[model samples]
Target: MNTSDLKTKIQNLYQDILINLDIEKIDDYFAENYVQETDHDTLNLNEFKDHLQKLKDVVKSLSIEKFNDMLIDEQQRSIFLRYDVAVEKVDNSMGNIEVYAIFKFNEVGKVISCRELSKAYHEELEGLANI
Candidate 1:
């Protein structure tokens, strides 16, 4: 795939699947044999689906604030993204997080694997440090 196509797919995967918590559409973006690593955890396709399901159960809402950067390597069929997102928990607590992910696509252009890292903080807590 070209750079634009890869970028769009990644964005759609984030907004459509992750933010929307649409587990049903997971297959549209991932290959049957998919794997993902986040921090110290590793998950296969089923495990990833379960993780999203759990998130859906606890998260009231999720929104992407902005995409900080995106780098595509057509030769390697991989892309890296850095973005910020906001999530509201079931109890209505809000968390802002920055995410960095590298995705590798299979021969057929489906996402085959990913490695990701994220850090969270409360935007409302920023002013407390100065008080």
Candidate 2:
């Protein structure tokens, strides 16, 4: 797909799926055979769905701060995004994080897989001064 098409899909995944927790959106954007990769390991579509469900259960609410950058390789049908994520912590505190992700789409314009890296921090930085 084209850059704008890819961007729209990513935005819909974030806005309609992740944020709203709309499982139905998954049907449209994510292939039923989709998978996810992380530094730790890979998860199949069902596993990934379960993972997101668990997070939704715990996080209560979550949001992406912004999408700072995006690159799409039409030939590979891949899209990369650098984004800032902000969320309400489990303890009711606030947290901000940065994430970079690769979204792999099928020839049919459905996301077939994804891989991501994220960096997160809390108040520990300030405490380190006393250490």
Candidate 3:
């Protein structure tokens, strides 16, 4: 697929899958063997779902602020995205943090694997809560 097509896929994942938590839509987008590398560690499909469920349950309001500088390598079928997210904790505290996520697509255009690393700012929020 082309860069534009890949961009649309990521955008849909952000809006429909991540933001909306539409599990039905996920099967259509992600490969059966999809993998996730998060700040906590690496996780396979079931692990990823469990982690996402935890995030969805704990993080009250989750929103992506910006996605910029998306570079796609058609040869390698990989996409690199630099973005930031705004999240409100269950305690009603809000914070924004920078993040980077890389997606590797399979031959059929499904996301085979994804790796995401983000700045840990939850501590900062807790500190502010005390102040």
Candidate 4:
């Protein structure tokens, strides 16, 4: 896929799949052997789907506030994005987070693997003393 197309797909993956919590459409974007790595754990496609399902059940609302940066390297078949996200739970508590995600796409343009690192609002202030 071209860089533009790859960028669009990455954006849609977040907006249409993650923000919308459309578990049924996961296959449309991810390869059958998709792998996801996070700070704590790594998951295959099925496990990742289950994680999304759990998030859908627990979080009342989710939004990607800004896609701050996107870089596509066609030669490496990789895409990177830095984004801000906001989530609100059923209890009305909310948090904003910043995330950096890297995706590797298959030849046909499906995401074969993804690695994400995120920092919550509070996590960014770990060394601060006064509130």
Best by lDDT: 1
Please tell me which model should have the higher lDDT, number 1 or number 2. Answer: 1
lDDT of 1: 0.82
Per model, state how many residue pairs clash: 0, 0, 0, 0
TM-score of every model versus the real structure: 0.90, 0.84, 0.86, 0.89
Clashes of 4: 0
Give the RMSD in angstroms, all C-alphas superposed, for model 2. 5.6
Residue 50 of model 4, lDDT score: 87
Error of 3 at 12 (Å): 0.5
User: 74-118, model 4: which lDDT tens digit per residue?
Assistant: 988899898877877666777776778899999999999989887
Judge candidate 4 at residue 43 and give its lDDT. 87
Q: What residue pairs clash in candidate 4, if any at all?
A: none
In model 4, which regions exceed 4 Å deviation? 122-131
lDDT of 3: 0.75
What C-alpha lDDT do the candidate models reach, one value each?
0.82, 0.73, 0.75, 0.80
Off by over 4 Å in 2: 123-131
Candidate 2 worst ten-residue window by lDDT: 122-131
Model 2 over residues 74-97: C-alpha lDDT tens digits?
889898998876666455767666
- How would you encode candidate 3's per-residue C-alpha lDDT over 5-77 as one tens digit per residue? 8888888888877677666677788898998876647778776667667666656776776686688998888
Q: Which consecutive 10 residues in model 1 have the weakest lDDT in total?
A: 122-131
